[model samples]
Target: MKKHQWMATLLSLICTGLGMFYIGTPGMIIGGMLLMALQGAALFIFFMTLGYLGLIIGPLAIGIHIIGLIIPVLYFSYRSPRKPMFDEKRRRQLSSPWKIVVRTIIGLALFAGSIYAGYTWGSAPFMKTAAEKREVQEAAESYLEQKYNEPFKVTDVDYTWAIGSYNLTAHPEKAPELEFTLSSNDASPPAISNDTYLNQLWGQQLRDRLKPLLDELYPDQAFGEAYVFAGSDTVERDYSRLANNADGDVSQNVRLIVFADLTADNLAQEKERVLELIRRLPSVTVPGETDLTIDYYAADLKTPESVKKVEQDIDDMKGKTSTYSFRVFDISDITSADDIEIRGLE
Candidate 1:
């Protein structure tokens, strides 16, 4: 074999160009290195095209070397098949470099076009849908404030639509109206009479017991009509009713529902009263299992000043009863009277 050919083969085998240096073809050495880079890129693309299993690695290795060898050989054949090898031939006598540059530019332009199209056409609608949710929440909150003379700092909201499947021959003109449905925790319907009445009574009794406890804890705050639910079914029903927007055929939209209300001017006093009530309310004690952290006693007491007193009362109660804990959420800013207008069928 020719000295340059022998060197090219060795360098291509070792990773292109190392053997070319031994043969003394500076031009062929550069071409061999370029071939090696192209071979590596082809192997990577091949793996990506396949499911990326290691099975393709063998074929990729063979294919890459073959292409690398053929390209340089073809270039040499065209340049000077009769040249007495390396030192006599100039490296720059090979193929045009401008072609490679043009192809690279085209590839980059295609990639950028795809990215722009995906952003504008494929992904923009989903972003708009997400933004719509925030707008719906704000609108629902505003509506509640206007309707009930109270601001509903809506803590939560959700919606679900009715589904339908039509037959192949279904009339296209008879399409149903697109309806909106709003659901929330506060708008849950009340349970059947027998399922929750007894528990309701128990809840009231617990509240009665708590009234005196609150009085003892904070003498300044007066306890108002405290609503309590004993059974989970009723509570669940009420919560669901509060959350669901049963109005209109769609029965879905935004539900700015209210859970509790305290008709008192002293927001701080009411908060303290509620907190004391929560702390004093009796709970079903389960031995050796602290996982059942029962804090069912909650009152939506509004106003910052009264809220402080409520916190102080909780601290005092904790000192007296170390085993108990409570979740004091602020529903004070929510006093919406806007009823969740229910459908007759619902």
Candidate 2:
């Protein structure tokens, strides 16, 4: 039986290398199996990674699909099937309108089925219902409380499919800002890390403690968002971040991004104000090894976009944050603002 290239290509269009069955040559059958296997592997990975692996697997699957669509165009050695497909003896008589219509319906059904499978199996795992989210939240809360022997609250449960776990934002009853991230996927045990919780805890405390100091020094709100972070030592030793430690390098270290506005009008005045602030920073009791990114903007030029990203928005600024921002200036990682020596300015 002569193979129909159009029939094979159309079948393969619905599924990669599906047309090979119609052609039925040994080489075609082998190629079809390999391409089909590749498609299956891609599907498995897409499910396992919860769709993140799609980008990595897309090209390979697409390449196979493309090949399946176009490969029928090239001439191949045609062979008869072991059991004659469609009963070649009755080919002419069964070429009636009803037979043709039935075949068309079957083809359409196949195409539709492929699409349905793609949606149902591929997406169903990642999408959870509200009840499922609530269940996960309860489970995570229970796990955290038992693990730490402390009362905790689960604010929300969110499934991050990229990592295949439900990420829970939770906090101890006493301190909400000192929140911890816990993950669960129901199959394995709920995972919680003390290291992550402690780091977040210390960072929150440092930020809170620094705010009052800023209020006293720069009373007119001269400073902006101060991302105060503690080093690994603070996380490990579990030191109270709020405690005043004059120790040079113990636990507290700030891998910090802070915004300090230049108060003066002219450039010279701005330099002087910045220098003064730099001199005063040492006295401010920021102990341990500290690195600072002090983004400087003009006091007058401070927009919601301009200063600290979103400390103040004079333009009816309540929630107009998350807008695109250009850097007013980039003085990042200046450990000692006093140690800065600009050749031209100096």
Candidate 3:
């Protein structure tokens, strides 16, 4: 077929470098194929990285499209190819404008199909369809109602790629903050992303018990963050869900992290007090192996950022930056207390 200029221009306009395909010259054909390969690679990378590569790939793809747009315009107007598009034998095919339009339509349809295929392959694993989302929501709702005896609504299902699970946001009908953070793999019951449910099972009671013991010891400073861990096991997400009955969370093995402020003068005394509190933990919760750490920080550097600055300042200040103020410690797997290690006191 004798390729027309307008058909070449139209194809390039919509399908990018595809116009070069119609130009029927060796250089143009090869250039069009190269552009096609580049565009395909860009699209695949964009999908695999979850669209993180869009900033770079987007501009490169558009630049290729612009080249496709200009190729036909420049060639037809300037005789830039300087060669006939088709030989006598090749020109025997259809030259009808209707047939040309039909060919263009077919090319466009194929291009669109390729795009849809790429999207399905790249994103389907990372997102849930409407029916799948609803299924996750229903599973979470049923699990919560049966376990907690409270009406819970599934608000949203977010696919967390890092953990490889679809985390469903389920909240009590009354309070949005009480999220159950239920997650599902579609093959089985959903796991919890947080401990709101476990708090009811035992975490809350433990928290309530720990607070009073710390109050008696320091009587003023509040706890920072608290965790109840099972003996030598660290998996926390599978604990209390009715469908998962994982007994790791039900174990009495626990650890406590406390923050305190003290100077060289009272460091030893405070350590003994914290150890006494750990000894008293048996009265409040079930007995099992435990780890207790008192993070001693300078009293004045209470904010996390400030304490972090001082912790890092030792390279320049030779450990003097937090000598008078700060917290202690990360003692683990213990019957606990601290030994006197006060320096720079004199």
Which of 2 and 3 is the better model by TM-score?
3
Flag regions of model 3 displaced more than 4 Å: 1-37, 45-120, 159-165, 174-176, 187-196, 199-201, 224-265, 289-298, 301-346
Candidate topping lDDT: 3
Give one digit per residue, the lDDT tens place, for model 2 in 162-251.
676777788888777556676677443445443255546555555555556556655644443333334333323234433343233433
The positional error of residue 264 in candidate 3, measured at the CA in angstroms, is 4.9
Query: How high a TM-score does candidate 1 get?
Result: 0.23
TM-score of 2: 0.47
lDDT of 1 at 88: 44
Q: CA RMSD for every model?
A: 19.1, 9.2, 10.4
Residue 207's lDDT within candidate 1 is 40
Give each model's whole-structure lDDT.
0.35, 0.53, 0.57
Scored against the true structure, residue 292 in model 2 reaches a CA lDDT of 38
Listed per model in order, the count of residue pairs whose N, CA or C atoms clash below 3 Å is: 26, 0, 12
Q: Which candidate is the best by TM-score?
A: 3
Worst 10-residue lDDT window, candidate 3: 310-319
